[model samples]
Target: MLEIVPIRSDSRARARVKVRPPAFLGEPEPDTSVGQEISKAGVGIILCAGALIGLGGFLFFIGGLLTSGGITGFVKGWLTAFTGI
Candidate 1:
């Protein structure tokens, strides 16, 4: 015959409150996790950098084409890209 022992209810809840791995389940509703916060910040930085680089490149290309030959240069560049010639 085996005897079963039950843990104290309050103690069990307290144990769950302690910070540990598998953050999705153990953390409280309002608490922020260190690892998760860093990951979110890193993603935000990468997205912002990509957006800035893409916009900057587009503006530089347009500026160069306009200064070189105005609207005619822009049209020429587009046609060359489309026709691969």
Candidate 2:
């Protein structure tokens, strides 16, 4: 035999009374030293810029033989046009 139970009418009766602690206690505080943050950011930017410049330079050297606009291109153009050699 199956018995059907009556549902509770009060919404407060179903509410939870126990509270759980947060995984993280509170908001993280920002770094107060502006100069240090700026210096670190600047160093990162400089390193990235230097790496990009070096990569471009290497690619220019490698592909210069096929084009007349790269570093080798300008040199070849100058020697052929100006020196007539």
How many clashes in each candidate?
0, 0
Give the Cα error of residue 33 in candidate 1, in Å: 1.1
Residues 1-85 of candidate 2: C-alpha lDDT, one tens digit per residue: 9999988777464566876454454332353367776787899999999999999998876676557667667688868989888
Residue 80 shift from truth in candidate 1, angstroms: 3.0
Best by lDDT: 1
Residue 70, model 2: lDDT of 71
| C-alpha TM-score for every candidate | 0.47, 0.41
* lDDT (tens digit, per residue) of candidate 1 on 2-49: 999987767743345666555376444556678887898899999999
lDDT (C-alpha) at residue 5 in model 1: 90
Worst lDDT window (10 residues) for model 1?
Answer: 12-21
Q: With candidate 1 superimposed using the best TM-score fit, by how many Å does residue 27's alpha carbon deviate from the native?
A: 16
Judge candidate 1 at residue 64 and give its lDDT: 77
